[model samples]
Target chain A: MPSPADKTARPTGFRVALRDARGHLDPHWWLVAPILILVVCLYLLPLGNVLLLSVSDPKPGLDNYERIATASGPLKVLLTTLRLCAITTVISIVLGFCVAFAMAHVRETHQRILVVAVLVPLWISVLIRAFSWLVLLRDQGPVNDWLMQSGAIDQPLALVRNELGVVIGMVHYLIPYAVLPIFAVMRGIDQRLLFASRSLGAGAVTTFLKVYLPLTLPGVFAATVIVFVFGLGFYVTPAILGGGRVVMLAESVSVAILQTVRWGFGAAQSVVLLVLTLVLIGIMAKTVGLKKGFG
Target chain B: MTDESAGQDIRLYGLSKYYGDFRALDDVNLHVAAGEFLTLLGPSGSGKSTLLMALAGFVEPTHGDIFVGGSSITALAPEKRDFGVVFQGYALFPHMTVAGNVGYPLKVRGLGKPEIAAKVRDALDLVQLGHLATRLPKQLSGGQQQRVALARALVFSPKMLLLDEPMGALDKKLRHDLQLELRQLHRRLGRTFVNVTHDQEEAMAMSDRIAIMRAGKIEQLGAPRALYDAPETRFVADFLGKSNFIEGKVTGIDAGIATLDTADGPVVHALGTRPAGIGDSLLLALRPQKLMLGPGPNSRKATVETAIFLGTHAEVSLRCASGLALALNLGIENAQALPAEGTTVELGWDPAATVAVRPD
Candidate 1:
């Protein structure tokens, strides 16, 4: 990379006066300096304090971190979180891909309606959505009643207060996240590529697999990063749906903080979630960037 | 690209495609001979592209039977039709490399990797883009991307190649160059090509025959020179090129020559004898180049209105005594000599140059 001074070597190029500005700060930074400072003080300070407490409180050291790595309790919570998030990501991506694909090809007014329908759920609070799912999936709910009345099931099935109920609520909450990104990408794809593929003697299935699917990988990768990260930090949905039976990472962190009052351990778990989400995004960004250009 | 696939003759019987009440292609019938390069030439909404798409099996005709090599393919799927289509916008797979795109048809045909790679190399070489095989479509220039599309379409050597405005996005120089290259390739491959374009110059220069369409119907179909020389209708003459309409009444008919009395004076149309009688009003389609400056069999006294110097020729506007305006393409030699605006001069042409047509 060229040095900053070299880049601004021509006076007309930048005229930043890097040396004269306060410790290399551009004069333009002054306009947003107050807001930037406030963001750091209010937002980053709390986040940094959380990380600091993970190692400082209760005699400090790596006690909370060691427990996260070695103890079965923290490990089990992490495992459950990872497993459920993976399942939710997969299901949401598959279902959202279908919705987005349909939206991409439909008529203009119909596509508008579909886009609103997909995004409207996000406006509804996750708490309300989770309760709705709980009501629908629990024993003696309408679904179970219908199944029993149809003679399909002898009794109400175990649907709520478990992993299944939690996944249902999380997938519902995460679906819009999956759909919007994928839909945006799918809409930009030229429909003629499909026709061109077909005319080149590739069948519909082959064209979808080879041309359409590859073109959509960037969107899928972005959705996976979003749905998975959002699934990790999800608090209310899992709490309401899990009913204290299927404890996940966020729920465990809440217990350690509010009930057991282990702020250090909770903060440690929070840092773990932050690191995991960042690492996933980092990995996804590489592949997404590689396939991002499609014009 | 292959000896086994020379070309296939295509026949469309009473093809009609209707969207609600709008007729995209109304009662169209056409026969393209084997190994012929035919162009469907028309302006937008004239259904030229629609006809090409129908042949490619992308657009199904509401009522028609399309036969290729004497076998009906009206119900065949686009993939099953085995036609190489170079779509408008090229539609190169952005995710795939150039070589991958060119190899796609062969890959779908289950060709071995070695054979596919070799053939892709040859196809790229055919378009003279072998070195850019590994680059993605977005990385190439527009003309390069167009060449890649051509390579991919011709890679598998399908029975025919369909191009929908293949040069629609190109500039004039590149379009002319590609037109020449495409024509040479057609001769080399001996494959039937059905191209759709609104550019009349492209149609005239590259096509073995041109099918001029208007309002979902073929206005005229013939070889380029034949169509230009003897357009059957005013629309054909106007759309294919610029034409000056002259109204006249047939005053005499003798010895296969018809003398018409125009407002300017008497003129003769000795090209050929047509269905005409004395005192019959007629419309003549006279091309700009056909209108000469010297006296000839058909002569008209006119005053020059304007003369604009173009590279090859100067386009002069003339208003005859009848107040009928005509455009003339004067050669550079005459353009350099003289004749200022409003200068009165006698404009003449061979009687054969004036083609009689219906007033429409």
Candidate 2:
């Protein structure tokens, strides 16, 4: 039988190039072709459509973007979204660091229990979790009832249908995302370095502050970016917990497209959110460097 | 580099540690003199590293006290004890540069910026790493990282320097070079140094005194030369270096000289403190280098089984008529004139060359 190399020798130009490319390509690429096709058809195609609609619909060329800049409603929604995402990122990261540190240092049996506690929420549906938080934080909810019964307040507190409710729900949803990366980095840190620092005249607090914290910074930074980005795109939890009272960017986009039937404006808002998230990630990557930050 | 006089003596009184039913350290009592270099030499499970950790305040003894400069420091935290420790793999902070790592201890002490900078520079220069001050620990080679660890540990002028197998991760050549450098550093700083290692050669090379441990107990403690010359037990003799044992019965004693009757014949010698009467069994420890291949006052006829030429000396294995195996370190000059393997020869040594040791 003639070798593929021999067969390729007879082909000219384009055919030869195609044959050569096929011969050199990895056979394993065939295994991933299905997933690649699915990503292009389901993800990239819709994203491209959104980008096109942002400029083409409603007479094209920057009208929706100008409205986003000049209109008060869209601007207020943008600010609220940014504010809620920032607050959620901070609270989730701080809580995640404490939980990750505890999990990393705890006994093996206790670590398993803590890990399950952090991961169980991820397995539950986001809508279900948001609904549960709504039920728990409402005026007639268990928390408010308990506070009233304990004589801490004369009436049930206003806990849901606001920015505070949106923040609480988003933080609850994003904590596992924050915990995983920080916990991974914390586990990789050598425990002996802590002992070395302590033995070299650093007290427990000093060792934790200087050695342990710095070594775990890469994890913390990665977790922060992940939580912030996830919070920026969050819709279900904020929509359910906010009870239509606290309108975020995602809720505004839905209102523009479904409630008002303004497709170009909704698509434009989405494009802006996407660009903003990318720009934030790019700036962070440039400043901290993904490699060094993770390491 | 700041002060050569900054060192404190350490003492352990009946120090012991237990892991459930297993005893890690058993009633260890040792006195490390100020500015002295003492090594804990033992096999892997002999608790040498545990003893070093106890000294560094990482491992708490179950029932005893550790005193530094005549004050009991058993309950003091490791940082308060002010003892510098170089771990097995050095444990340099990967995120910090060499200068930053060296300055860490000073920074923890709340030293001023200029003072910390000067001290960090001095510490790095002392370790000959001043040029690599800005490089992270990961960028340096193993030996360089080890030097950085040494600089960091010594920057704060610690009371005592505890090393837990500091050279265990280096190659043979690097380990040898670091051993010499460490010895010189000990001499220059005049700091009390407590090093732990399983390598007997390293212990003998750098230690002023060595405590040979076995099964959680110290079998012997003395200077390197003393330990090599007179091991107290068969375990110590075997662990420190090679030794040949001769089992016999004590036939007579006169003027501190005891005559022993072996299966082959009666051998006379005066060594060891164990008292023995007639018909009592005793063991004798002999160094192979001391045994000569010729007829002397105490001589035995043996057949050579194998002879290996080792450049300066030839190692010969021999078997006597009574089935006793012996090893001899023959000089190259004498070995050149010796007969080939399977040949009969007479082996002898001076009675003073043998020492009495308790059998394991």
Candidate 3:
């Protein structure tokens, strides 16, 4: 057989150089190439175009950003989006924790059923879910009708077409996303540590507070990041349930581009949202230090 | 390092546990003396660990009560029992420093910070891990982790220390060293220790009294020497060490001595407390070390099939003319004089060296 040096000496071209580079790389890198190509074309290209349009679409340099900084309407929209996202993240995390804890400790059959209950909503169309929430929370809906008829209220309550309806719809959509990452981490915790804690003279509440709670912090952190980031970009459920009354940033961006034909302002708002999301994530990662957060 | 008061005595009265239809612990009654080391020895799934868990108040007994210092504690929760347990895998908290882990029990008891710190130091020093107090459990080696576990368990100075195969995860040399350290610790503290293990040599090395369990019951409980020298059943004899079982029929009983008629010849032996009748079958448990490989009154001709030379002694497998196989443990000097394999030799033993045991 010819030696490796002899075989390499016979090939000298771009193809050979590519082959040589491939030999030095891990074989698993090849499996990732297709997804990498798709992400660059479908995600990165559109994102880069939006960034360029933010500065160059209309009369150039800093006009849209100046409007974002000084205009009261845009500032109010930004504050409302941040407030709604925070509320949705906190509510989703609390509800998701209880569900994931139940799923982790219940019998195997019950756990399977609970997992399906959490995941089945994901398979349903988001539009259909938003419409169902709209019907349920309307003025003449079943909840308001029952409350008025039962003497619990003197008048039909305004449950939909408002901020409350938008939050309700957003939290409902964000819960399954919160549950998956938290459940994954919670299941990996070693159970023997709990028994050891009890045997060392810790009561049930104390054991949970001292041992069980600390071990599940990594899971809680991951779930918070997921739910908060998803809540920031939420548009469909809020749009349907708000009934055009509660306007979030995503809706404002669409109105600027489609109704008003202000492409630079819409693209500038998109760039601001992206930058804000990244800055928030960067702050959290610095505070927790990703290695410690995952542990 | 805490005050070494005499530990409390524990007693179990007809303790039993049933998991659906399978009995994990069946009617176990035992007494643990104050300041004694008692070991439960058995094979896997023989309920040794189950019995330990029942004692620790984790597995509630179905049909009985446990008493510590003459007060029934059967209904008490595990935290109320005040017993420290070292689990099989050590189970040290991976997130806590060594000092933090050791100070946890005291912290839960509402002690002041300075006192907790002082006690934690003493406890770690007791296990000779004082210098490693700042290290997390994941940063330590396996043996160091085990010591940290021991220190954490002993920090509160519990009434009794319970260990479930504490050294089962260590390699052989580390296991031996830890066994010695545990023995020394038990002696120094003078606290009641209940340990569970399947290794016979470990049980023999560390236990003041051993309870050999089989099928969820204590088959025999006694001092280690007594159980080894005079086991009451074939299972006990075989489990504790090597033994040769000789089957024969009783032919005569005269003056407390019974003569057994074997296929090779008649053998005379002093009858133990177990009753036997003429013409009834009897089983005898004879230790391999008790048989001599030379001419004597109880001598029998045998052919050596295989001889294994160990440094201290040699084990020779022999077969008699009656087709009974016997093992002879010869000393180094006597082994040097042994003929080659397939050579015929004489094996003998004193009548008092063999004991009658239940067949099963």
The residue-by-residue lDDT of candidate 1 on A32-101, one tens digit each, is 7899999999989999999999998786798999999899989989999999999999999999899989
Candidate 1 per-residue C-alpha lDDT over B16-103 given as tens digits, one digit per residue, 9 for 90 to 100: 8999999999999999999999999998999999999899988989998999989999999999998989989999998889998999
- The sequence of per-residue lDDT tens digits that candidate 3 reaches over residues B20-93 is 99988999999999889999999998899999999888898889989998899999998888888998888898
All candidates' TM-scores? 0.91, 0.89, 0.89
RMSD of 2: 5.0
Q: Tell me, by lDDT, which candidate is best.
A: 1
Cα shift from native, residue B279, model 3 (Å):
2.0
In CAPRI terms, model 2 is classed as medium
lDDT of 1 at B357: 75
The per-model DockQ list reads 0.79, 0.69, 0.64
| lDDT accuracy of residue B130 in candidate 3 | 96
iRMS of each prediction:
0.6, 0.8, 0.9
Best by TM-score: 1
Candidate 1 residues lying further than 4 Å off, grouped into runs, are A1-37, A289-295, B1-3, B263-266, B271-273, B294-303, B342-346
Q: Model 2, stretches more than 4 Å misplaced? A: A1-23, A280-295, B1-6, B252-275, B291-350
Cα lDDT computed for each candidate against the true fold:
0.89, 0.89, 0.87
Give the alpha carbon lDDT tens digit for every residue of A34-95 in model 2: 99999999999999999999898888798999888889988888888888999999999999
